[model samples]
Target chain A: MKRVLIAAALSTTALTATSAAAQTEIEFWHDKTGRLGELLKEQVATFNGMQSDYVVVESQKGNYSEVLNAGIAAFRAGEQPDILLVFEVGTATMMAAEGAIKPVYEVMAEAGADFDADGFIGAVKGYYTTNDGQMLSMPYNSSTPVLWVNRDKLQEAGINPDVDLSTWQNVGDVLDQLKAAGVDCPMTTAWQSWVHLENLSAYHDVPFATKENGFSGTDTELAFNGPVQVQHISTMGEWARDGKFIYAGRRNEGGANFRGGDCALFTESSAGYAGINAEAKFEFEVRPLPYWEGVDGAPMNTIIGGASLWVLAGQTDEEYKGVAEFLNFLSSPEIQAKWHQDTGYLPITSAAGDLTREQGFYDENPGTDIAVIQMTANQPTANSKGLRLGSFDQIRGIIDEELEAVWSGDKTAQAALDSAAERGNALLRRFEQATR
Target chain B: MEKRVRFKGLWLPLLLVMPQLLITAVFFFYPAGQAIWQSLFIPDPFGLSMRYVGLGNFEFLLSDPFYRASFVTTAVFSILVTLVSMGVALYLAVLADRLIKGSGTYRTLLIWPYAVAPAVAGVLWLFMFNTRVGVVTWYLGVLGYDWNHVLNQGEAMGLVVVASAWGRISYNFLFFLAGLQAIPRSVIEAAAIDGARFWTRFRTIVFPLLSPTTFFLLVVNIVYAFFETFGVIHTITSGGPQQATTILVYKVYADGFVGQDLGSSAAQSVILLVIVGILTIIQFKYIERRVHY
Candidate 1:
């Protein structure tokens, strides 16, 4: 009699819990912590409030590289999340992951949503697309390199506050003046290889690698050791020697110095505005990335950084449908515009940009539009589209090591670039061979 | 009589050892075997397909200049870490052994650092010596020494070595202390009464008796330096300033996790396994021969 009573009570509890669990759950793995993490949670809450059929569970999964590692390990264990956020550099690896990911275009089409591929900005969309221009992933947070100037520091150094810094020559003159005026850190840059070499090559309309920067073929060779690249790197090396440029660690380690008002000029992602706006007590300004005037096609559009959302395979059709709906909700003009204005990421769509402009957000935030203009100023050339090389993350490490050598005055700029290119080519060949 | 208790039946003995054998196979042999197997093939990122390239990965690693440089760096790093940690620990143990009161308090205080994780220790040291805003760096600057490890290869290497050794000193200290306490006090007293000074007593009697402990520690410290210092290097220098601190293990991690070159990383792991095996064998052989000393 007692056992039967307990069994009846357990069954009743089970039924109540089942009824409460009606909503399907979708797992989202992202690489945003702190402010971005809170924004992501807010978006998830809004989506959940708007729906009764699904609940999206967002989890912070470390930084970009760590998150990618987690996703790969999870996929290997057959326990991957429904959605994975991958940085721009990992696009080729994800694309080559045949039978692993479901293309975004197909998901939208299957869900019967009014999806327009052309709605996204061309430069942002081109980075994660197939050869025929089919979208592979949804652009989540797009950013481009820009010049960040501490106006207070510049003025303290007795330099003109409105000195034209649109060209490298002008920036050089300013750097000399800052050095002469006893500025400790005249210029420091985050992601030196990205801001100094990669974007520099793109803005000069020079190829960083052959075969359209590996978008057309995997058998591409690094051409970043060309005379234009050599000239720019050697100039930076000279600046480093003269204490006009500070050699910070790789990957945004210099952000602290720049935002702390110790640096007069910083070349970093436009996304830095969110952090700078929150922490910087000094006046700062965002300006266009300077171009080298000697190049024929100087001031070309810069490539994109940040990450995109990929739809992993091996999920139920219902889950995919839910993912499609959630993505559509995220890309809505109001949400995209709010995310752009709040986080300093580029508005992924033209409609979102238009909405943000119509709301007069650009007028209030003057330098926020610099990243968009820098990315969309011209139709992307073959050189400026973006890199799609396999094993590019590893190649970036090699480049970083060589760049550090140059900064330390251990190797000549030309020698370092030549070595970096040679080393990078070996990895590229290995990648090509493996993929084939 | 040989102190041996033979099992009545062989089945009982076999059954008694089965659990341990199963655990060793499951935890150690299985992963090692898998690494060896994977080292011979290159797989796609998704691992949907694999292509066999026998010994190709090993060849590539052997030919890579950075990998070769990492081997030299690892050797230098392990030697420095083992020497520094063991040397400091021996000194501390000797001082504590001489104390008659408050010895337990000293031991307790010294063992506290062992409880801190190696990665956390690395971070602590990095905070003190960071080039831009570190307290130590600022003091050095005031003394006319501009310390910048980001550009200085020697400074970067020294920082990682110190960070790695600092966390290990506590562990080595415990072993050395125990070894010192295990020595019979009578032998030291006789040496002292026979007109020998403190240094003479330690050299003739105490040092000879402690040879076994030192030998054991040599092997243990070498292994600790080789395998356990990755966290310290990762946290502090990240093998930076021209790969000056990039040891073998750090290279393996960078290639496998960051680079996603699984075959190369696997081959590197296999090489490390063989290296460890050889090192253990050499230690055993040498220690056995030197036991009579």
Candidate 2:
């Protein structure tokens, strides 16, 4: 009797929900919550309202990493979503997978969707593009690293809040002054491995890894233990030992330190704009990430972060078309422009950047366009482009471990980096063998 | 009569037992067996990579430096947290027993943390230890303690221990409270009247009765600290200002999922399983005997 009643209730619930309506439903799963998640929902709602022939249902799967995991797990179970949002680090891993994903360009072309390949910003597009210019994933919220200055703290430290901080040498001097001025937390950072080793390598025009940072081939090895990376790490170690640079835990724990107005200076993502704007009562400024003084091409553009939307394989053609329409809508210049202006992630397209500029938004905000400028300042070198190695996420954990040792005064900068490269490369070999 | 007995007793019992055995085989044994197989064969989840590595993965783990550190950290954390929480839980349980009127109310509030998800517990403890915005940090600063986990190793260790303990305190409270309630009050009262002080009373009177509960909690708290505390550790520390907090499970997650290094991750998982298994055996062989009933 109970089982029969449960079956009747389930049928009633299903009838109340869908009523067997045929609207070509497409599942769009993401990892954004809070303001970002709300924004995503709003976009989906707009798309859904614009048409009756198709329904684009966007759902919050989890956080960035969790969503990726869920996507992969679902794909294995043959229940993958039509669209999946993936962060930059997972790009190489996804790309390395043979049949788990369908390239975005193919999906766009298959749907006969109106997509101008040239419309995407080169830096943003290049990260997700193949060697022959085939787009792999749609860039949704790409951000580059920049120095976040708590202007109030610097001013209180008796230093000029607007002083040029484009070079590490100058930043070091300023840190010393801040320390002398009784600032306990002069500097902290988010994504130390990224900002320190990654953009650090790019800014200096040096390779972080061979085989084009694992893009051209899986046989890539860590080149970060070379002189440039070692020097930067050693300098940071010196600062850490001197109490000038506080070592917050991995991820963005130090972001709290920065946003709380305790830390005088921070190196973090440009997309941190929303949080800092909301929580901080102190004056803050965004500047280009500091590069080492005297390095050739020391101020080259940094790589992109944030995340992108990936259309998974194993979906029906009609669902693929909906995904295409959704991607195209998301790519529209007005949509892109407004998203960039509001969220502080880079405008993914040239037209969006132009629109943002024409609206006088960049000029009005002063530092709002700095992320764009830093990313598009110069042609990217082999080193300046994004890393795309299999097992990169594991490799980053190894890097985190080594970097921590340096912070704790257990190992010197060179030693820590040497250990990281050696350990990271062994995993690289294992990954290479697996992929081969 | 024989046919009736076979149909009623043996066949019916077999039918009733089938579902549980099937579930165990499918859910638990299946994945574990696959992990062991995958570790030896070294198949990438991506399907683009597969290799016969044999025991190469294990050999790599044995030689890895961070492997040693993670194993040590997990062992140390599990051992210390189990001992500390057990002691604290027993003490609190005795105190609750003394409160004849408000015992239920105290028990309810005491096990409140048990209702919180591990991730939530981690976040709450993180709020307390946040160097910039934390209540504990403010007090620690006032007391002139070096309280920054981001900069200090000792402080980082303290933060991990605090977070680990807070997450399990709820379960411990529940377990200990139940054990104390089951203990007959006449024994404790007799010891008290025989001129026993609080400590002496606890040692000679109520202690023997609570042994079974203590045994259960010892195993439980050990498993929790080893397996369950990773959520808190991952969120609060991500294992360090350096690698100070990277335990076995953290490395496993980082390697298998984050790094997408399936082989190495599997090896790490195997090691974790072995360690926990050994601990379980030790508890059963050595500790279970002490239980009074």
Candidate 3:
């Protein structure tokens, strides 16, 4: 009798759920996993519970590349989700996909959703905006590269744990000291191309590509082979030869070494805090990414890494309204603040950052504000705004290969960067022609 | 009288072969035709816009130094994987055949690695050679020889080759063991009675009778190394360390799925198809001539 009652209860719930078909379902496909995935699902549930007209469903589509590919494939088949999470490098590809996506601003205007374009932080907003200041996509889960120091390892190397690593010169001196003190891995890095070449060009206020890093037009060529980038890579190469810097794999393979207390320093995404804080047995600190002192506008700003939510085209009016409402919910101060605290991603809006500070979250967790400060410290110049090149994912593969050549001593920095630029420009030309 | 069975009517024979023909058309010919068609044009990411280039992609790829270099790399990788896997399997099969006791258990143990997927096998090997926490890397460090496959080209190639071959050894071993067991005992006994040594008898008698199996495995293993080892390379090296391990198939995946350049990827697949076709033809026409069966 109890089993029959349970089955009857389930049947009733299913019937009620079918009867409430008035709730327009909004499908959101993203690439977040682990704690972040859970938090995203929680936000979706909260949004669903807070309203009667909309029910948001979330799905994981593997990593960033997989998500983009899946989105494209689905779009081709006329079965696309309401929203897609595309990484920053794919901005150009998404933008050129003319009829495949609906701009976020248009969605807001059509649905009469509350959206203040100016409320978003300048650096983060500028990445996904056009020259006429139109937002293309909703910014979400953005982060910048920073320096992570293993405090225990520093002290063991006879160096002060509080030593300032603001400048590359000071970091070099500390690396020498750590090497002399018998440390095997003085420094290591993840996302070598991002932290070394792309971010280095932006932070030093040098162009990574011509035509304002491809924001102005698609006919741009790579300019990262310039003197500034070459010098930075050359220094890293020298350090690799000196045993002061250890070369890891192309991606975040060094995170394991650093978290295991085998490396003294790691240059990785600020979002790495979510993993490092939970796994590290030793104390660690986050610092602003170092810059060279001699550059004219050194330490200007670091661009964001991580993905943003883009509204896809060809959805019903009701579904679009649901999507717009969900996006608005995501941008609210409480939700954004909680997300920023839970993950190390930057809060998209100034109101969210202010709310976190007012709640004393940053005070309780020191160094949590470094990414925001570094991003908003200066008005982003044309060079520092962000890269928006076509086929940038492939271009980054070329850059990774060239960078590996430099690290392995197979080629000098200048030669490798030159080859990378030449190869990357070929893909850029192909992109331009195909889009045209 | 002829031993071959004769069909009564044309319609019956056609109906009997319809399922296989349908399956082949859907699975093989359709995709191959689509790849050829797509290779002639460049399609945008959404596939809504397609511009005809008329062999432009092939021209560009033929001129690319990196693509040309990958051809050489694939040649070296497939050759090494085929030789190593086949050689080791043959040696193990010979040893297992010589065992009088517990041979069944030995054969079962030798066949276990065939159960592992290519990607899983790659990860297992990667964990052992990882620079930071790898047990073998640590041991090598203690022995005063550092093993950093991430940076070393030769080491990267060697590691991927071994990892690709490790999973294939089980498959080859099973075939070799069956082929060895099928050899008639009377011939070996007669040779032994004539005062012939074990090495001479095996080389002259057993090897000749095993030629059919050997030739078949040669063709299959070569094809396996060329096509199916992509998972192993992708999981282990991702065609890295300056594209040292970038086999043709891995390049096809990187360009098509990851890079989103469908036209170039299609063109590459067509080229790979032609290469494999030529390889199979050469093997059948030349290598099969030496087999007695």
Candidate 4:
């Protein structure tokens, strides 16, 4: 009798929930935190207020790597959400999960949402799209590497605050001056492999790996140990030995050092603006990523970092439609412009960039549009397009270890990169064979 | 002499042990069996297709230089952790056991570190040694000693070992304190009356009787260092400075979750299982022989 009454009560609650609002529930899992998380929540609230057909429930699931791992584990258990935000490095892993994800193009078309593939900036879209130019995921918080200058530190080090750091040569001279002026850490970097190697290759129009950085096929091999990369690494190694370049941990551990006013120069993601702007007491400025002046066609645009939103497969039609509508709302120019302004992420569409410019945001906040201009300034070459390789995340780990050897003076720049390339190639071959 | 009792009905005895048997089969045996099976085959991310290659993954790992280096690292780490944690724990337990009135308070205070999670312990140690803002690092710097674990292999390994061992000391301390209390006080008192010093009494009388607990803790601490310290390594070093602290378990995680290579990870796990099995067998054999001494 008790079980019968419990079942009746549960059924009554369920009926009331459905009858009051027949809202299709879409679970959107992400890894944004702090101000970015608040902004995402605000967007969700706005969407929910705009219409009542669908209620998007957003959940913060750990950091970037944790979220991807959780999404995969959930999919294997057949309990994945309708949408997942995956970091850029996990693009290959997500793409290889056949039948586990629904391409955004198909979701948009099925839902009849107005999504123009051409509206997205080419360089940003190229990273997540197929060979046939189909976008597999929506680029959500794209960022590129840039030089972060602490004006106070530079001035305190007896260097001109308005000095040009547009070239690596000029930056090296300034670093020497800062070191001579008794600055402890003249320069530090976050995401060493990303800023120093990956973006360095792209900014100089060189291939980080073969087969167009693994976009053509799975048989790609590492080519980042070339002369241009070696030169840059050897220079950094010299700086490290001279106590000018401090080697922080692999990821964004140096962000703390830079924000704490201990470092004079930091090469980090443009999304660093949100943090530096918030925590940095000294006057700091975002400058264009430095390039090697010796190389021809140098200072090319950089590739995107950050993450994108992928629509997972196996949800119902109505649920997928809800996901599509949400993404479409997120892609609208007004929302994109606001997200770009708020988070310092790249405006995904040219329209958003133009809108922000028309609103005089660029004039109000100088150097705010540098990332957008950097990404859209040039047609990305075959080498500068982006890397989409299997086992890339692991390969990055190998590269980080080898680079640390150089920083410690245990190995030469060429030797470290060479060893790193060799070790990375073995993993690539294993990945190729595994996915074959 | 050994005494044994036999139940009247076999079915009743089997029924009595059914729950234990069922749990073992579900949790332990099932996963072990799956890992063994998966080691022989490589599956895609979606598990849509699997290619059977018996012993292929094992062969690859055997040839990998980094995998072999991790073995040496794991051995060094496990030994250091066991020795440091147990040695410190034994010393603390002996001290607490000597106290007549405040023994309970000392025991309670010593066991507090056991409550800290391994990851939290690692983060605490990391902050203290962080190159940028660490108070300890800054003090070391002032004393003309540069402490940068990011580039120094030995420092990285040292940091992980200390962090891992710090969390295990409380558990070992609890067991050691209990074992000390269990020893007959009259035996030590009689030795003391005979003009034996404290160290002599502890060495000659107290140490021999506490051998059982010591052996037990050695085995437990070794296993804890092996399988349970991945969180410490992950939070602290992440197996860096050229894989200085990448133990077998850490490698399994790095390859499986970070690299998305399940087959190799499973193969590594199977290898780790065999190592643990041998270690456990050896430990139990030693314990059996020492328990009678």
Q: Clash pairs of candidate 4?
A: none
Q: Could you give candidate 3's per-residue lDDT for residues B1-293 as a string of tens digits?
A: 33797768799889989999999999999999999999998999899799999999999899999999999999999999999999999999989989999999998888899999999999999999998888999999999988999999999999999999998999999999899999989999999999999899989998898899899999999899889999889888999988999999999999899888999999999999999999999999998889877
lDDT score at residue A68, model 4, on the 0-100 scale: 89
Task: Compare candidates 1 and 2 on DockQ and give the better one.
Answer: 1
How do the residues A240-339 of candidate 2 rate in per-residue lDDT, one tens digit apiece?
9898998776677788889988899999899999889899989899999988888888888799887888888877898888889989999998889988
Of the true interface contacts, each candidate retains a share of 0.74, 0.68, 0.77, 0.72
Off by over 4 Å in 2: A1-23, A51-53, B1-23, B46-50, B98-101, B167-170, B173-210, B289-293
Tell me how many clashing residue pairs each candidate has: 0, 5, 0, 0
Model 2, B1-293: lDDT tens digits are 12353445677788899999899999978988878877885666655447999999999889887788777877777777777777777778768877979777888888887778877878888888777778988898899976778656666766777777865776777788888888787887888788899888778666878788888888888888888888888877777756667788888887776666778788778877888899899989988877777
Candidate that beats the other on lDDT, 1 or 4, i.e. the better one: 4
Q: Tell me, by lDDT, which candidate is best.
A: 3
**What's each prediction's TM-score?**
0.96, 0.90, 0.97, 0.96
Residue A188 displacement (Å), model 1: 0.5
* True lDDT of residue B214, candidate 3: 90
Best candidate according to TM-score: 3
Per residue, candidate 4 scores C-alpha lDDT tens digits across A1-436 of 2243355557678666554346777889999888899999999999999998888889999998889888988888988889999999999878877689999999999999888999999999999998889999999999999999999999998889999999999999999899899999899999999999999999999999999998898899999999999999999999999999998889999999999999999999999998999999999999999999989879888999989999999999999989999999999999999999998999998899999999999999999989888888899988998998888889999999999989999999999999999989988888777778
Note the chain A TM-score of all models in turn: 0.95, 0.95, 0.96, 0.96
**What is the docking quality class of candidate 4?**
medium
Which CAPRI tier for candidate 2? medium
Candidate 1 chain B weakest ten by summed lDDT = B284-293
DockQ, structure candidate 1: 0.74
